[model samples]
Target: MNTTPSYRTIAGDGLWSNNLGLVQLLGLCPLLAVSGTAINGLGLGLATLLVLLGANLCVSLIRHWIRPEIRIPVFVLIIASFVTAVELLMSAYFHQLFLILGIFIPLIVTNCGILGRAEAFASKQPPLPAAADALAVGGGFLLVLVVLGGLRELLAQGTLFSQAHLMFGDWGRGLSVTLLEDYRGYLLAALPPGAFIGLGLLLALKNLIDQRRAAVAKAAPALTTQQANTP
Candidate 1:
């Protein structure tokens, strides 16, 4: 039997079981800092996703040439190169959202999620699986960031997708929805504390869901055995 993990297993790990945000808890800095609004989260999330895909593919392609002693530095250089490219692309195309993302855009260099995947999985795998892993893991982070941002924005301003023009161009301006007209915003949900509280709630929900799934999986075997014995 082949011991190597299949593409599906790697994707599953990245998307859910070993998610960088909900499970591994990597990349919290960007995750929490820019998630105050849905648009902000989306901008940064897309940037991170692009960087991850590029870095992972590059690392996997060059893994054989990388020596163990110098792998860390090489990985950093590769990731930084990709991040800079992404930053420049954003600045050129989405100048407004680029400014809004600010320092965090460059800060993708230090995102443990990217570097960790490069070291742990990408360097040891082929380009295709590495790319798949990047898609799944980056997607998972993007999903969490967007959800958290939307939740915080809804609570703080009673609006969803506020400032739609940042990422989506002028047409995005019409995307903002007012959930409660003339409603007072919740200040806490817009603050750093709000990020922490919101993240904690999300973590709790993820754990609850995982536990339920595990319980069901555990009972499934027993059910199958009992049905077979009954016959």
Candidate 2:
């Protein structure tokens, strides 16, 4: 029995089955707060991704040196350090976006998702696997952020990628699209309640897809046996 997990399994779990935003539902505070627009979500998501990558790799590298008694604190310190670095970098380069994100930038340190990955998978895995896990998990979270943000933004303002210049340069100013010229905005989709509702809908959609896949897999073998016995 090959007890070792494959990269496909790790990626599958991080991207879909065990997603931070959709499945595990970790880091919802930041996820919901900054996801008012696609750019806001993209900004925060990239920052979180950077921190996760750095923290996971560092934790995996030093796993052997850390004492079991103080591992939790050690992992937190590592995550905090990476979060600080990400915050500073964003402030310097994406100043406008940074100011908009405000305290949430530093709050990434408290994100249970990052800490959970460090203690759960990173601590036990090698550097390569740890980094891969971080990428997969972070990517999954990023996808949800961008998708939710875009949906909210479109519903509320009839625009996608509004204020693109905040992240991209002057050229990005042209990226925003006015999908609805005379469209009346929906106020609810722009509020906190909207975030919850949107996320719930997304969760339901994912569950529906998963249920369909499960049904198909279950029927496959039985169908094969029936066909073989028929003729």
Candidate 3:
């Protein structure tokens, strides 16, 4: 069996090769639901990042003591505890935003991304590296959420940071940045169907780019071979 990978490998895997949002496609329910606005997405994404980091750290620290038969349950328990803490903190501090998040906030316990990281990476690595990996994965997931949220918000409302004060302080109330005054909001872009459609288009665009890159790589080899034969 291989030992723990280097930090560079962990970062690359979490950010790209094994991205929780884009590559692995884990945790779609909340990812789709709470990403309607940038602030909503940012709140949930930050909460998830905390939970992931906490869960991974706990799992890594205790992996050796836990038996194979009971490991999953232990991991779940650890993750659930973190989720509960996050929920309570949100309710106490950001009550309005917490209410808006509702069931999705508690549902973080069931996110496959958290459990998958626990079993796949944390279970096999040390606490420090596992924590780093969680941060990387969580950051990548947050990036996707924020971008998707911004896209939906811009298309649907023609404004960014419309509700910044909900999560931030009173000073943030003035941070609402309007993109267009004459803009007519796209109702479809603010709905559930719009989230799905936007995500699909984003995925398609990523695939198209990958395909184009591959085609260029293939052509480069063929061109080199033809030039070598000509000379």
| Candidate whose lDDT is highest | 2
Residue-by-residue lDDT tens digits, candidate 3, 1-231: 749888999888887667788888899999999899989999999999999999999999998899999998999999999999999999999999999989999999999999999999899998999999999999888887888898899999998878899988798789888998989899998999989987887778767877898999989999999999995
User: What value of lDDT does candidate 2 attain over all alpha carbons?
Assistant: 0.94
Q: Could you tell which candidate, 1 or 3, scores higher by lDDT?
A: 1
lDDT of 1 by residue, 60-145 (tens): 99999999999999999999999999999999999988988899999999999899999988898888888999999999899999
**Per-prediction RMSD in angstroms?**
1.7, 1.5, 2.0
How accurate locally, in lDDT, is each candidate? 0.92, 0.94, 0.91
The list of candidate 1 runs beyond 4 A from truth reads 1-4
Clash pairs, model 2 backbone: none
How do the predictions measure up, each by TM-score? 0.95, 0.97, 0.92
Best model number under TM-score: 2
Steric clash pairs (candidate 3): none
- Model 2, 78-148: lDDT tens digits are 99999888988998999999999999999999999999999989998888889999999999999999999
- For model 3, what is the error of residue 180's alpha carbon versus the real structure, in angstroms, after optimal superposition? 1.2
User: Which model, 1 or 2, shows the larger lDDT?
Assistant: 2
Candidate 2 versus the native: TM-score?
0.97
Candidate 1 clash figure, as a count: 0
